[model samples]
Target: MAIARTWKSHSVLPGFGLALGFTILYLSLIVLIPLSATFIKSAELSLGEFWAVVTAPRALASYRLSFGAAAIGALLNAGFGLLTAWILVRYTFPGKRLVDAFVDLPFALPTAVAGIALTAVYAPNGWLGQWLEPLGIKVAFTPLGVVVALTFIGLPFVVRTVQPVLEDLEAEIEEAAACLGANRWQTFARVLLPALWPALITGFALAFARAVGEYGSVVFIAGNMPMISEISPLLIITKLEQHEYAGATAIAVVMLVASFALLLVINSLQWWVSHRHGRKQ
Candidate 1:
Protein backbone atom coordinates (compact mmCIF):
# COMPACT_ATOMS: atom_id res chain seq x y z
CA MET A 1 0.00 0.00 0.00
CA ALA A 2 1.15 3.55 -0.73
CA ILE A 3 2.01 5.81 2.18
CA ALA A 4 -0.67 8.36 2.89
CA ARG A 5 -0.25 12.02 2.02
CA THR A 6 -1.80 13.28 5.26
CA TRP A 7 -1.99 16.98 4.37
CA LYS A 8 -3.80 16.24 1.10
CA SER A 9 -6.12 13.73 2.71
CA HIS A 10 -7.27 16.08 5.51
CA SER A 11 -8.14 18.98 3.17
CA VAL A 12 -6.80 21.43 5.76
CA LEU A 13 -6.03 24.12 3.18
CA PRO A 14 -9.51 25.63 3.33
CA GLY A 15 -8.90 26.82 6.89
CA PHE A 16 -5.52 28.22 5.95
CA GLY A 17 -7.03 29.87 2.90
CA LEU A 18 -9.67 31.51 5.03
CA ALA A 19 -7.03 32.78 7.47
CA LEU A 20 -4.90 34.16 4.63
CA GLY A 21 -7.93 35.88 3.13
CA PHE A 22 -8.74 37.66 6.39
CA THR A 23 -5.11 38.67 6.90
CA ILE A 24 -4.89 40.35 3.50
CA LEU A 25 -8.28 41.98 3.88
CA TYR A 26 -7.36 43.35 7.30
CA LEU A 27 -4.04 44.67 6.05
CA SER A 28 -5.65 46.33 3.04
CA LEU A 29 -8.26 48.06 5.13
CA ILE A 30 -5.90 49.30 7.83
CA VAL A 31 -2.49 49.73 6.21
CA LEU A 32 -2.48 49.49 2.44
CA ILE A 33 -5.43 51.75 1.76
CA PRO A 34 -4.18 54.51 4.03
CA LEU A 35 -0.68 54.36 2.52
CA SER A 36 -2.15 54.36 -0.96
CA ALA A 37 -4.08 57.50 -0.05
CA THR A 38 -0.80 59.19 0.95
CA PHE A 39 0.75 58.23 -2.39
CA ILE A 40 -2.32 59.48 -4.24
CA LYS A 41 -2.31 62.80 -2.43
CA SER A 42 1.40 63.23 -3.09
CA ALA A 43 0.94 62.41 -6.78
CA GLU A 44 -1.05 65.62 -7.17
CA LEU A 45 2.07 67.74 -6.72
CA SER A 46 4.32 68.65 -9.65
CA LEU A 47 7.92 67.35 -9.43
CA GLY A 48 9.29 70.84 -8.71
CA GLU A 49 6.59 71.51 -6.16
CA PHE A 50 7.29 68.22 -4.44
CA TRP A 51 11.00 68.97 -4.36
CA ALA A 52 10.32 72.48 -3.06
CA VAL A 53 8.19 71.16 -0.23
CA VAL A 54 10.50 68.32 0.78
CA THR A 55 13.87 70.03 0.31
CA ALA A 56 12.99 73.40 1.80
CA PRO A 57 15.40 74.46 4.57
CA ARG A 58 12.91 74.01 7.36
CA ALA A 59 11.87 70.57 6.15
CA LEU A 60 15.50 69.51 5.69
CA ALA A 61 16.27 70.60 9.22
CA SER A 62 13.43 68.52 10.59
CA TYR A 63 14.72 65.51 8.69
CA ARG A 64 18.16 66.03 10.15
CA LEU A 65 16.88 66.33 13.72
CA SER A 66 14.60 63.36 13.34
CA PHE A 67 16.90 60.90 11.58
CA GLY A 68 20.09 62.15 13.24
CA ALA A 69 18.95 61.96 16.86
CA ALA A 70 17.19 58.67 16.16
CA ALA A 71 20.39 57.14 14.75
CA ILE A 72 22.43 58.36 17.69
CA GLY A 73 19.90 57.12 20.22
CA ALA A 74 19.71 53.73 18.52
CA LEU A 75 23.48 53.36 18.55
CA LEU A 76 23.58 54.15 22.23
CA ASN A 77 20.90 51.60 22.91
CA ALA A 78 22.72 48.86 21.00
CA GLY A 79 25.71 49.16 23.33
CA PHE A 80 23.81 49.59 26.58
CA GLY A 81 21.09 47.15 25.57
CA LEU A 82 23.72 44.43 25.06
CA LEU A 83 24.95 44.97 28.60
CA THR A 84 21.39 44.90 29.90
CA ALA A 85 20.58 41.69 28.07
CA TRP A 86 23.79 40.10 29.28
CA ILE A 87 22.94 41.01 32.85
CA LEU A 88 19.46 39.56 32.56
CA VAL A 89 20.68 36.34 30.95
CA ARG A 90 24.06 35.57 32.54
CA TYR A 91 23.33 36.15 36.20
CA THR A 92 20.81 36.23 38.96
CA PHE A 93 20.77 38.74 41.78
CA PRO A 94 18.35 40.33 44.19
CA GLY A 95 15.76 42.31 42.22
CA LYS A 96 16.89 40.79 38.95
CA ARG A 97 13.29 40.06 38.01
CA LEU A 98 12.32 43.62 38.83
CA VAL A 99 15.03 44.96 36.58
CA ASP A 100 13.85 42.71 33.77
CA ALA A 101 10.28 43.93 34.22
CA PHE A 102 11.41 47.53 34.27
CA VAL A 103 12.62 47.13 30.71
CA ASP A 104 8.99 47.00 29.58
CA LEU A 105 7.96 50.18 31.38
CA PRO A 106 8.25 52.25 28.24
CA PHE A 107 5.99 49.87 26.40
CA ALA A 108 3.30 50.02 29.07
CA LEU A 109 3.56 53.70 29.96
CA PRO A 110 1.32 56.03 28.00
CA THR A 111 3.38 58.08 25.59
CA ALA A 112 1.83 61.34 26.75
CA VAL A 113 2.49 60.52 30.38
CA ALA A 114 6.08 59.60 29.64
CA GLY A 115 6.47 62.83 27.71
CA ILE A 116 5.12 64.86 30.57
CA ALA A 117 7.31 63.09 33.09
CA LEU A 118 10.39 63.52 30.96
CA THR A 119 9.67 67.18 30.35
CA ALA A 120 9.22 67.80 34.05
CA VAL A 121 12.46 66.03 34.88
CA TYR A 122 14.53 67.69 32.17
CA ALA A 123 13.06 71.16 31.91
CA PRO A 124 15.31 74.04 33.00
CA ASN A 125 13.58 74.49 36.35
CA GLY A 126 12.80 70.84 36.88
CA TRP A 127 14.58 68.60 39.41
CA LEU A 128 17.55 67.24 37.46
CA GLY A 129 17.48 70.21 35.12
CA GLN A 130 18.06 72.64 37.98
CA TRP A 131 21.51 71.19 38.45
CA LEU A 132 22.40 70.79 34.74
CA GLU A 133 21.19 74.24 33.68
CA PRO A 134 23.64 75.99 36.03
CA LEU A 135 26.46 74.40 34.06
CA GLY A 136 24.85 75.54 30.73
CA ILE A 137 23.71 72.05 29.84
CA LYS A 138 20.34 72.44 28.20
CA VAL A 139 18.09 69.41 27.93
CA ALA A 140 14.50 70.46 27.49
CA PHE A 141 13.11 72.63 24.66
CA THR A 142 16.19 71.86 22.57
CA PRO A 143 17.62 69.21 20.28
CA LEU A 144 19.12 67.50 23.29
CA GLY A 145 15.60 66.92 24.64
CA VAL A 146 14.71 65.26 21.36
CA VAL A 147 17.62 62.90 21.79
CA VAL A 148 16.55 62.15 25.34
CA ALA A 149 12.96 61.38 24.35
CA LEU A 150 14.09 59.27 21.43
CA THR A 151 16.47 57.42 23.70
CA PHE A 152 13.71 56.80 26.23
CA ILE A 153 11.35 55.22 23.74
CA GLY A 154 13.98 53.50 21.60
CA LEU A 155 15.72 51.65 24.43
CA PRO A 156 13.05 49.00 24.93
CA PHE A 157 13.32 48.00 21.31
CA VAL A 158 17.03 47.26 21.58
CA VAL A 159 16.69 45.49 24.93
CA ARG A 160 13.76 43.35 23.87
CA THR A 161 15.28 42.49 20.50
CA VAL A 162 18.58 41.46 22.03
CA GLN A 163 17.24 39.63 25.08
CA PRO A 164 15.80 36.71 23.16
CA VAL A 165 18.96 36.07 21.19
CA LEU A 166 20.94 36.19 24.39
CA GLU A 167 18.64 33.68 25.99
CA ASP A 168 18.86 31.29 23.05
CA LEU A 169 22.68 31.32 23.05
CA GLU A 170 24.22 28.10 24.25
CA ALA A 171 26.60 28.24 27.20
CA GLU A 172 28.51 25.24 25.94
CA ILE A 173 30.29 27.23 23.27
CA GLU A 174 31.59 29.74 25.80
CA GLU A 175 32.75 26.91 28.09
CA ALA A 176 34.50 25.13 25.24
CA ALA A 177 36.19 28.36 24.09
CA ALA A 178 37.40 28.92 27.64
CA CYS A 179 38.57 25.31 27.88
CA LEU A 180 40.61 25.89 24.71
CA GLY A 181 42.34 28.89 26.38
CA ALA A 182 40.17 31.70 25.02
CA ASN A 183 39.88 34.71 27.30
CA ARG A 184 36.47 36.21 28.09
CA TRP A 185 36.90 39.01 25.56
CA GLN A 186 38.39 36.67 22.98
CA THR A 187 35.55 34.16 23.23
CA PHE A 188 32.88 36.86 23.17
CA ALA A 189 34.37 38.68 20.20
CA ARG A 190 34.98 35.51 18.21
CA VAL A 191 31.92 33.44 19.11
CA LEU A 192 29.14 35.47 20.72
CA LEU A 193 29.39 38.58 18.54
CA PRO A 194 28.61 36.82 15.27
CA ALA A 195 25.42 35.21 16.55
CA LEU A 196 24.12 38.39 18.20
CA TRP A 197 25.16 40.75 15.40
CA PRO A 198 21.90 40.33 13.48
CA ALA A 199 19.79 40.92 16.57
CA LEU A 200 21.70 44.09 17.40
CA ILE A 201 21.23 45.41 13.88
CA THR A 202 17.55 44.57 13.92
CA GLY A 203 17.13 46.30 17.24
CA PHE A 204 18.94 49.36 15.98
CA ALA A 205 16.69 49.47 12.92
CA LEU A 206 13.59 49.06 15.05
CA ALA A 207 14.62 51.84 17.42
CA PHE A 208 15.52 54.13 14.51
CA ALA A 209 12.20 53.59 12.77
CA ARG A 210 10.23 54.13 15.96
CA ALA A 211 12.06 57.37 16.70
CA VAL A 212 11.67 58.69 13.13
CA GLY A 213 7.91 59.28 13.28
CA GLU A 214 7.56 59.67 17.03
CA TYR A 215 5.26 62.56 17.92
CA GLY A 216 3.45 62.04 21.20
CA SER A 217 6.48 61.63 23.44
CA VAL A 218 8.49 64.29 21.58
CA VAL A 219 6.02 67.11 21.02
CA PHE A 220 5.55 68.22 24.63
CA ILE A 221 9.30 68.26 25.25
CA ALA A 222 10.43 69.64 21.86
CA GLY A 223 8.88 73.10 22.49
CA ASN A 224 8.05 73.02 18.74
CA MET A 225 10.51 75.82 17.96
CA PRO A 226 10.21 76.20 14.22
CA MET A 227 13.30 75.43 12.10
CA ILE A 228 15.20 74.43 15.23
CA SER A 229 13.80 71.87 17.69
CA GLU A 230 10.92 71.16 15.30
CA ILE A 231 10.46 67.59 14.01
CA SER A 232 8.88 66.40 10.74
CA PRO A 233 5.72 65.05 12.38
CA LEU A 234 5.13 68.42 14.04
CA LEU A 235 5.74 70.17 10.74
CA ILE A 236 3.14 67.97 9.11
CA ILE A 237 0.72 68.86 11.91
CA THR A 238 1.48 72.55 11.60
CA LYS A 239 0.75 72.40 7.89
CA LEU A 240 -2.46 70.49 8.51
CA GLU A 241 -3.55 72.97 11.17
CA GLN A 242 -3.00 75.74 8.64
CA HIS A 243 -5.00 73.71 6.09
CA GLU A 244 -2.01 73.07 3.85
CA TYR A 245 -2.94 69.49 3.02
CA ALA A 246 -0.84 69.33 -0.12
CA GLY A 247 2.28 70.48 1.68
CA ALA A 248 1.62 68.03 4.49
CA THR A 249 1.30 65.11 2.10
CA ALA A 250 4.41 66.18 0.27
CA ILE A 251 6.51 65.95 3.43
CA ALA A 252 4.85 62.65 4.32
CA VAL A 253 5.79 61.24 0.93
CA VAL A 254 9.39 62.30 1.35
CA MET A 255 9.56 60.59 4.74
CA LEU A 256 7.94 57.50 3.29
CA VAL A 257 10.51 57.28 0.52
CA ALA A 258 13.48 57.95 2.79
CA SER A 259 12.32 55.50 5.42
CA PHE A 260 11.77 52.86 2.75
CA ALA A 261 15.29 53.32 1.42
CA LEU A 262 16.77 53.14 4.92
CA LEU A 263 14.89 49.98 5.83
CA LEU A 264 15.89 48.37 2.55
CA VAL A 265 19.57 48.96 3.27
CA ILE A 266 19.25 47.62 6.82
CA ASN A 267 17.35 44.58 5.59
CA SER A 268 20.02 43.85 3.00
CA LEU A 269 22.69 43.99 5.67
CA GLN A 270 20.67 41.64 7.86
CA TRP A 271 20.25 39.23 4.97
CA TRP A 272 23.98 39.23 4.23
CA VAL A 273 24.79 38.50 7.87
CA SER A 274 22.27 35.69 8.09
CA HIS A 275 23.41 34.14 4.83
CA ARG A 276 27.07 34.23 5.80
CA HIS A 277 26.25 32.68 9.19
CA GLY A 278 24.27 29.95 7.45
CA ARG A 279 27.18 29.13 5.14
CA LYS A 280 29.48 28.75 8.13
CA GLN A 281 26.94 26.44 9.76
Candidate 2:
Protein backbone atom coordinates (compact mmCIF):
# COMPACT_ATOMS: atom_id res chain seq x y z
CA MET A 1 0.00 0.00 0.00
CA ALA A 2 2.73 2.44 0.94
CA ILE A 3 4.71 1.70 -2.22
CA ALA A 4 1.63 2.17 -4.37
CA ARG A 5 0.85 5.51 -2.68
CA THR A 6 4.40 6.66 -3.27
CA TRP A 7 4.18 5.71 -6.94
CA LYS A 8 0.88 7.58 -7.29
CA SER A 9 2.34 10.62 -5.59
CA HIS A 10 5.30 10.47 -7.93
CA SER A 11 2.90 10.48 -10.82
CA VAL A 12 1.43 13.73 -9.49
CA LEU A 13 4.91 15.26 -9.75
CA PRO A 14 5.92 13.03 -12.64
CA GLY A 15 8.34 15.43 -14.21
CA PHE A 16 9.81 16.67 -10.95
CA GLY A 17 12.81 14.42 -11.02
CA LEU A 18 13.32 14.93 -14.72
CA ALA A 19 13.11 18.69 -14.37
CA LEU A 20 15.54 18.78 -11.49
CA GLY A 21 17.88 16.41 -13.26
CA PHE A 22 17.84 18.49 -16.39
CA THR A 23 18.36 21.72 -14.51
CA ILE A 24 21.28 20.40 -12.49
CA LEU A 25 22.94 18.84 -15.52
CA TYR A 26 22.44 21.92 -17.65
CA LEU A 27 23.76 24.29 -15.01
CA SER A 28 26.74 22.07 -14.33
CA LEU A 29 27.61 21.79 -17.99
CA ILE A 30 27.07 25.38 -18.92
CA VAL A 31 27.84 27.50 -15.85
CA LEU A 32 29.07 25.69 -12.76
CA ILE A 33 31.56 23.41 -14.50
CA PRO A 34 33.14 26.18 -16.56
CA LEU A 35 33.31 28.51 -13.57
CA SER A 36 34.66 25.75 -11.39
CA ALA A 37 37.41 25.09 -13.91
CA THR A 38 38.32 28.78 -13.79
CA PHE A 39 38.52 28.70 -10.02
CA ILE A 40 40.63 25.58 -10.17
CA LYS A 41 43.05 27.26 -12.54
CA SER A 42 43.03 30.50 -10.61
CA ALA A 43 43.64 28.60 -7.39
CA GLU A 44 46.99 27.46 -8.76
CA LEU A 45 48.09 31.06 -8.36
CA SER A 46 49.34 32.15 -4.95
CA LEU A 47 47.42 34.93 -3.28
CA GLY A 48 50.15 37.36 -4.25
CA GLU A 49 50.16 36.04 -7.79
CA PHE A 50 46.41 36.41 -8.04
CA TRP A 51 46.58 39.95 -6.69
CA ALA A 52 49.42 40.81 -9.01
CA VAL A 53 47.55 39.47 -11.99
CA VAL A 54 44.36 41.40 -11.20
CA THR A 55 45.83 44.56 -9.71
CA ALA A 56 48.58 45.43 -12.11
CA PRO A 57 48.23 49.15 -12.66
CA ARG A 58 47.26 48.51 -16.25
CA ALA A 59 44.79 45.78 -15.41
CA LEU A 60 43.18 47.77 -12.62
CA ALA A 61 42.88 50.76 -14.88
CA SER A 62 41.24 48.65 -17.52
CA TYR A 63 38.83 47.29 -14.92
CA ARG A 64 37.89 50.79 -13.90
CA LEU A 65 37.44 51.89 -17.48
CA SER A 66 35.39 48.85 -18.43
CA PHE A 67 33.04 48.96 -15.45
CA GLY A 68 32.81 52.75 -15.45
CA ALA A 69 31.96 53.00 -19.12
CA ALA A 70 29.43 50.23 -18.77
CA ALA A 71 27.75 51.99 -15.84
CA ILE A 72 27.63 55.33 -17.60
CA GLY A 73 26.43 53.70 -20.78
CA ALA A 74 23.70 51.83 -18.93
CA LEU A 75 22.54 55.04 -17.29
CA LEU A 76 22.51 56.87 -20.58
CA ASN A 77 20.62 54.02 -22.20
CA ALA A 78 18.03 53.91 -19.43
CA GLY A 79 17.17 57.56 -19.92
CA PHE A 80 17.33 57.58 -23.68
CA GLY A 81 15.68 54.19 -23.98
CA LEU A 82 12.77 55.43 -21.97
CA LEU A 83 12.46 58.39 -24.28
CA THR A 84 12.81 56.22 -27.35
CA ALA A 85 10.26 53.70 -26.14
CA TRP A 86 7.85 56.49 -25.28
CA ILE A 87 8.23 57.91 -28.75
CA LEU A 88 7.78 54.56 -30.44
CA VAL A 89 4.75 53.66 -28.40
CA ARG A 90 2.98 57.01 -28.19
CA TYR A 91 3.66 58.63 -31.52
CA THR A 92 3.17 57.82 -35.17
CA PHE A 93 5.16 59.63 -37.77
CA PRO A 94 6.68 59.17 -41.23
CA GLY A 95 9.39 56.49 -41.28
CA LYS A 96 8.21 55.15 -37.94
CA ARG A 97 8.59 51.56 -39.01
CA LEU A 98 12.02 52.23 -40.49
CA VAL A 99 13.14 53.89 -37.30
CA ASP A 100 11.79 50.95 -35.33
CA ALA A 101 13.67 48.47 -37.47
CA PHE A 102 16.86 50.46 -37.11
CA VAL A 103 16.75 50.05 -33.36
CA ASP A 104 17.84 46.42 -33.77
CA LEU A 105 20.86 47.24 -35.92
CA PRO A 106 23.27 46.74 -33.07
CA PHE A 107 21.86 43.30 -32.50
CA ALA A 108 22.12 42.27 -36.14
CA LEU A 109 25.34 43.95 -37.30
CA PRO A 110 28.62 42.09 -36.84
CA THR A 111 30.57 43.57 -33.97
CA ALA A 112 33.74 43.80 -36.05
CA VAL A 113 31.97 45.67 -38.79
CA ALA A 114 30.38 47.95 -36.23
CA GLY A 115 33.80 48.55 -34.74
CA ILE A 116 35.34 49.45 -38.06
CA ALA A 117 32.46 51.70 -39.02
CA LEU A 118 32.51 53.47 -35.67
CA THR A 119 36.26 53.97 -35.76
CA ALA A 120 36.14 55.36 -39.27
CA VAL A 121 33.34 57.74 -38.45
CA TYR A 122 34.96 58.91 -35.23
CA ALA A 123 38.58 59.03 -36.23
CA PRO A 124 39.95 62.56 -36.66
CA ASN A 125 40.30 62.07 -40.41
CA GLY A 126 36.81 60.71 -40.85
CA TRP A 127 33.66 62.66 -41.66
CA LEU A 128 32.15 63.81 -38.36
CA GLY A 129 35.44 63.37 -36.57
CA GLN A 130 37.01 65.87 -38.95
CA TRP A 131 34.64 68.57 -37.76
CA LEU A 132 35.15 67.62 -34.11
CA GLU A 133 38.93 67.39 -34.37
CA PRO A 134 39.30 71.16 -34.34
CA LEU A 135 37.46 71.17 -31.02
CA GLY A 136 39.98 68.64 -29.68
CA ILE A 137 37.21 66.20 -28.81
CA LYS A 138 39.05 63.07 -29.84
CA VAL A 139 36.55 60.24 -29.99
CA ALA A 140 38.49 57.38 -31.55
CA PHE A 141 41.03 55.31 -29.63
CA THR A 142 40.06 57.05 -26.39
CA PRO A 143 37.90 56.42 -23.33
CA LEU A 144 35.16 58.33 -25.10
CA GLY A 145 35.28 55.77 -27.87
CA VAL A 146 34.94 52.92 -25.39
CA VAL A 147 31.89 54.56 -23.90
CA VAL A 148 30.52 55.09 -27.37
CA ALA A 149 30.91 51.43 -28.26
CA LEU A 150 29.45 50.23 -24.99
CA THR A 151 26.58 52.65 -25.43
CA PHE A 152 26.00 51.47 -28.96
CA ILE A 153 25.74 47.83 -27.92
CA GLY A 154 23.81 48.43 -24.71
CA LEU A 155 21.17 50.70 -26.20
CA PRO A 156 19.25 47.91 -27.85
CA PHE A 157 19.01 45.91 -24.62
CA VAL A 158 17.35 48.79 -22.84
CA VAL A 159 15.13 49.94 -25.65
CA ARG A 160 13.86 46.48 -26.52
CA THR A 161 13.38 45.38 -22.92
CA VAL A 162 11.38 48.47 -22.08
CA GLN A 163 9.35 48.63 -25.28
CA PRO A 164 6.90 45.83 -24.62
CA VAL A 165 6.28 46.98 -21.06
CA LEU A 166 5.59 50.49 -22.27
CA GLU A 167 3.23 49.20 -24.93
CA ASP A 168 1.21 47.16 -22.45
CA LEU A 169 0.80 50.10 -20.06
CA GLU A 170 -2.69 51.50 -19.85
CA ALA A 171 -3.11 55.01 -21.15
CA GLU A 172 -6.37 55.24 -19.26
CA ILE A 173 -4.52 55.54 -15.97
CA GLU A 174 -2.54 58.54 -17.19
CA GLU A 175 -5.64 60.05 -18.73
CA ALA A 176 -7.52 59.64 -15.47
CA ALA A 177 -4.74 61.40 -13.63
CA ALA A 178 -4.79 64.25 -16.13
CA CYS A 179 -8.55 64.43 -16.11
CA LEU A 180 -8.39 64.65 -12.33
CA GLY A 181 -6.33 67.86 -12.76
CA ALA A 182 -2.81 66.49 -12.67
CA ASN A 183 -0.33 68.06 -15.02
CA ARG A 184 1.71 66.15 -17.63
CA TRP A 185 4.85 66.10 -15.54
CA GLN A 186 2.96 65.10 -12.42
CA THR A 187 1.14 62.32 -14.22
CA PHE A 188 4.40 60.91 -15.47
CA ALA A 189 6.23 61.33 -12.20
CA ARG A 190 3.58 60.13 -9.80
CA VAL A 191 1.62 57.71 -11.91
CA LEU A 192 3.57 56.44 -14.88
CA LEU A 193 7.12 56.28 -13.60
CA PRO A 194 6.51 53.72 -10.83
CA ALA A 195 5.02 51.19 -13.21
CA LEU A 196 7.95 51.51 -15.57
CA TRP A 197 10.62 51.44 -12.88
CA PRO A 198 10.93 47.65 -12.80
CA ALA A 199 11.30 47.35 -16.55
CA LEU A 200 13.84 50.17 -16.60
CA ILE A 201 15.91 48.46 -13.92
CA THR A 202 15.74 45.16 -15.78
CA GLY A 203 16.81 46.84 -19.00
CA PHE A 204 19.58 48.70 -17.26
CA ALA A 205 20.93 45.52 -15.69
CA LEU A 206 20.75 43.65 -18.98
CA ALA A 207 22.65 46.43 -20.76
CA PHE A 208 25.20 46.71 -18.02
CA ALA A 209 25.90 42.97 -18.11
CA ARG A 210 26.20 42.92 -21.88
CA ALA A 211 28.52 45.92 -21.94
CA VAL A 212 30.79 44.52 -19.26
CA GLY A 213 31.78 41.52 -21.36
CA GLU A 214 31.91 43.28 -24.71
CA TYR A 215 35.25 42.99 -26.54
CA GLY A 216 35.40 43.17 -30.32
CA SER A 217 33.59 46.46 -30.83
CA VAL A 218 35.61 48.14 -28.13
CA VAL A 219 39.07 46.94 -29.17
CA PHE A 220 39.50 48.85 -32.44
CA ILE A 221 38.35 52.19 -31.12
CA ALA A 222 39.99 51.75 -27.72
CA GLY A 223 43.45 51.68 -29.32
CA ASN A 224 44.33 48.97 -26.80
CA MET A 225 45.99 51.63 -24.67
CA PRO A 226 46.89 50.04 -21.36
CA MET A 227 45.95 52.03 -18.27
CA ILE A 228 43.84 54.20 -20.53
CA SER A 229 41.09 53.00 -22.85
CA GLU A 230 41.71 49.26 -22.52
CA ILE A 231 38.83 47.23 -21.08
CA SER A 232 38.93 44.16 -18.82
CA PRO A 233 37.85 41.65 -21.45
CA LEU A 234 40.76 42.79 -23.61
CA LEU A 235 43.05 42.33 -20.65
CA ILE A 236 41.84 38.75 -20.21
CA ILE A 237 42.52 38.03 -23.84
CA THR A 238 45.92 39.65 -23.51
CA LYS A 239 46.75 37.26 -20.70
CA LEU A 240 45.56 34.33 -22.79
CA GLU A 241 47.70 35.50 -25.73
CA GLN A 242 50.75 35.49 -23.50
CA HIS A 243 49.91 31.92 -22.38
CA GLU A 244 49.27 33.00 -18.80
CA TYR A 245 46.28 30.77 -18.27
CA ALA A 246 46.24 31.22 -14.51
CA GLY A 247 46.31 34.98 -14.83
CA ALA A 248 43.56 34.90 -17.40
CA THR A 249 41.39 32.67 -15.26
CA ALA A 250 42.01 34.86 -12.23
CA ILE A 251 40.78 37.91 -14.11
CA ALA A 252 37.88 35.95 -15.53
CA VAL A 253 36.90 34.79 -12.05
CA VAL A 254 37.04 38.34 -10.80
CA MET A 255 34.81 39.48 -13.63
CA LEU A 256 32.39 36.65 -12.96
CA VAL A 257 32.15 37.46 -9.26
CA ALA A 258 31.78 41.17 -9.89
CA SER A 259 29.10 40.60 -12.45
CA PHE A 260 27.24 38.21 -10.17
CA ALA A 261 27.40 40.70 -7.32
CA LEU A 262 26.12 43.48 -9.53
CA LEU A 263 23.17 41.41 -10.69
CA LEU A 264 22.46 40.44 -7.09
CA VAL A 265 22.30 44.09 -6.09
CA ILE A 266 20.01 44.78 -9.00
CA ASN A 267 17.82 41.83 -8.06
CA SER A 268 17.45 43.10 -4.52
CA LEU A 269 16.45 46.49 -5.86
CA GLN A 270 13.97 44.78 -8.18
CA TRP A 271 12.47 42.93 -5.26
CA TRP A 272 12.11 46.06 -3.20
CA VAL A 273 10.48 47.91 -6.06
CA SER A 274 8.16 45.00 -6.67
CA HIS A 275 7.25 44.73 -3.01
CA ARG A 276 6.46 48.42 -2.76
CA HIS A 277 4.48 48.23 -5.94
CA GLY A 278 2.49 45.33 -4.58
CA ARG A 279 1.78 47.29 -1.42
CA LYS A 280 0.51 50.22 -3.42
CA GLN A 281 -1.76 47.93 -5.33
Best by TM-score: 2
Q: After superposition, how far is residue 135 of candidate 1 from its true place, in Å?
A: 2.2
Q: Tens digits of per-residue lDDT for model 1 on 213-250?
A: 88999998988887899999999999899998889999
Clashing pairs in 1: none
TM-score between model 2 and native: 0.92
Off by over 4 Å in 1: 1-24
Runs of candidate 2 exceeding 4 Å displacement: 1-17
Residue 208's lDDT within candidate 2 is 97
Error of 2 at 122 (Å): 0.2
lDDT (0 to 1) per candidate: 0.89, 0.90
Ten residues in sequence with the least summed lDDT for candidate 1? 1-10
Could you give me the TM-score of model 1 versus the true structure?
Answer: 0.90
The 10 consecutive residues of candidate 2 with the worst lDDT sum are 1-10
